[model samples]
Target: MRAMVYRGPYKIRVEEKDIPRIEHPNDAIVRVTLAAICGSDLHLYHGLMPDTRVGMSFGHEFIGVVDQVGASVQNVQPGDRVMVPFNIFCGSCWYCARGLYSNCHNVNPNATAVGGIYGYSHTCGGYDGGQAEYVRVPFADVGPALIPDWMSEEDAVLLTDAAPTGYFGAQLGDIAQGDTVVVFGAGPVGLVAAQSSWLMGAGRVIVIDHLEYRLEKARTFANAETYNFTEYDDIVVALKRQTDFLGADVAIDAVGAEADGNLLQHVTSAKLKLQGGSPVALNWAIDSVRKGATISVIGAYGPIFSAVKFGDAMNKGLTLRMNQCPVKRQWPRLFEHVHNGYLKPSELVTHRVPLEHIAEGYHVFSAKLDGCIKPLVVPTAA
Candidate 1:
């Protein structure tokens, strides 16, 4: 098997590796058909996430065919195509029973925060991801679902993480009828969040980003107003002005860890690793929403602390809601949306690179070259 191996910060390569075998009674081995490089994967790629060791693969959004299943795996069988959610969770835990799969207590040893994520880092349970020919899926019965006959391979792959997370971000916002929602960042997640906001009954949607291409995507794909924050002297003030000086009814921060717009914050957090992540986007979200509005944060941040405007949020009585997306929880509605042509998850895909050329794929995506947004990885053997 050939897998993408992380060597160090900003370095990765395709290397031959042994095929993974079932290690637990509930485990299954999947032959990956399609996988996506998520925006959050860049955190691990750039050494922003803690314990992202060398030789580990980085991917969480993937769909594959079941190559083999363990004795206890009953939901799927060999030869079945399945969509694997990013979270590896046991369905019977207290958190899982409550539909909080991302905080499942029975998966990760360090389950104080995030549960289990594929190929995310030691802090996320150290499981290898599916950016390869094969991957080992634990708790297979709970995490994977057969791909719907109507779902495209690209759509199935995005549902594993990026699409679901974006929907989850909108879900956290609790948008009311006629609410004006503002989204930070215009990456895959942000674009999806902006689009989902409309489905959630938001009267208006706005997306902010520094890139022209992504802002344009928000305008075209999401049918939302777009703003290039780089053009404003103070983006928060600009957002307030756009909302008639009262601020937006809701704000979503989809950019995490590597947010720009500040020199000292970016240097101390993203560059020097002094803080968990740059707080620019999150802070902007804090100030851009109305005093009593809601803010949803779906961005990936390091385990360490970062500078955030907690005081202002408390003073303004803002509702702050965020968590890793419980991917499977959003599947039912997302499937319906897709079936009805209400959403097209595949439209977010910008590039598909073979596993052999993943090194180049990572470079292109990390550098944001050629308008790369969501890049898919296909196994060489596929």
Candidate 2:
């Protein structure tokens, strides 16, 4: 099998590797059919996440055919075409029973925080991801769902992460009808958040980003207003002006550690690793929303401390909600939305790279070249 292996910061290559075999009774071996390079993967690529070992594969959003299953795996069979959520968890745990699979206690040693995520890092459980010809899926009965007959492979792959996380961000907002929502970052998650806000009855949606191409996508795909923060002297003030000076009813930070508004913050957090992650987006979210409004954060960040505006949030009585999304929890409604033509997840896919050319794929995506919004990886076996 050929898998994308991480060598170090800014270094990745597709190399031949052994196909993972079932290790637990509940495990399944999936032959990947479609996989995506998520924006969060860039954090790992750039050495932002801790404990990301060399030779580890980095991919979480994937769909595949079940190649084999262990004795206890009953929900899926060898030939089943399935979409695996990014989470790896035991369904009977306290957190899983409460629909908080992302924090399942029985999976990762770091269960105090996030649960097992495929191909993330040792901190999230050193499970290898599916950016290859095959991957090992633990707790098969709880995580892998058969792809719906009506869904395309591209759409199924996105559901594994970006789509669900975006939808979860909107759900956390608790948007009231006619409320104005502003989303920071126009990446896949942000674009989807902006689009999902409309479905949640937000009267207006605005997406912010530095790139013109992504902002254009926000306007067309989400049917929302767009702003280039690079053009503004102060983005929070600009957002307030757009919301008639009271600030938006809800604000979401979809851009995580690599946010690039403040040069010093970006340097200290992203370059120097002095802080867990840059809090520019989250701080902007806190300042851009009304005093009593909600702020949803779905961006990926390191486990260490970040310099967020906790004092201001408390002073303004803002409801700040954030977590690694429980991806499977959002599938039922998301499936309905996709089935009804309300969303075309595949529309966000901009490039398709063969498994052999994945290094180039990573370069293009990291460099933001060729208008690469979302890039899919096609294994040779696919």
Alpha-carbon RMSD of each model: 0.8, 0.8
lDDT string for model 1 (1-382, tens) is 9999999998999999999988899999999998989888988898888888999988898999999999998889999999999999999999999999999998888647889999999899989999999999999899999998978999999889888889899989999989999999999999889989999999999999999999888889999998898899999999999999999999999998889899899899877888999989999999888999999999988989999989999999999999999999999999999788777889989999999999899889989999998999998877
Best by lDDT: 2
Task: Compose the digit string of candidate 2's lDDT tens values, residues 1-382.
Answer: 9999999999999899999988999999999999999999998998988999999998999999999999998899999999999999898999999999999999898546889999999998999999999999999999999999999999999999999899899999999899999999999999899989999999999999999999999988989899999999999889889988999999998999888899998898888878889999999999889999999999988887888989999999999999899999999999999899787788899999998899999999999999999999999999
Candidate 1, clashing residue pairs? none
**Could you tell me which 10 consecutive residues in candidate 2 have the lowest summed lDDT?**
105-114
Q: Rate the local accuracy (lDDT) of all candidates.
A: 0.92, 0.93
Per-model tally of clashing residue pairs:
0, 0
> All candidates' TM-scores?
0.99, 0.99
